[model samples]
Target: MRSDIVPVLELGAYAAHIPYHMTWAHEQLPYTPEHERFLELECISDILEHLL
Candidate 1:
């Protein structure tokens, strides 16, 4: 199960397991030149973006 769907399941709500062939923009991580060096920073950025 996807991590995004866990909260809904925990609430005892119904959720369908649908697979997609294409990736959505929001689902895609931003590209960075220094991927290895800034990996943790990138993750924090993603989390903050989602929160907002």
Candidate 2:
């Protein structure tokens, strides 16, 4: 389990730590041409719908 989620669980509230398979663009990394391919992906929205 993630340490960050421990506090929420201690408070008796629900928490989840979902890991994404994709690596999103980072400020420190150079922008690659291939990153554009995932720019329009809607996977997060789909995940949020289920989580919410």
Say which candidate scores most in TM-score.
2
36 in model 2: Cα distance from truth in Å? 39
Query: Candidate 2 residues 1-52, lDDT tens each?
Result: 2344445555666554444555444422342123211222335565465456
Write down the lDDT of every candidate, Cα atoms only.
0.41, 0.41
For every model shown, the clashing-pair count is 0, 0
List, residue by residue over 1-52, the lDDT tens digit for candidate 1. 2344445555665443333557676654444222221212223345454346
lDDT of 1: 0.41
TM-score of each: 0.34, 0.35
Quote the lDDT for 13 in model 2: 62
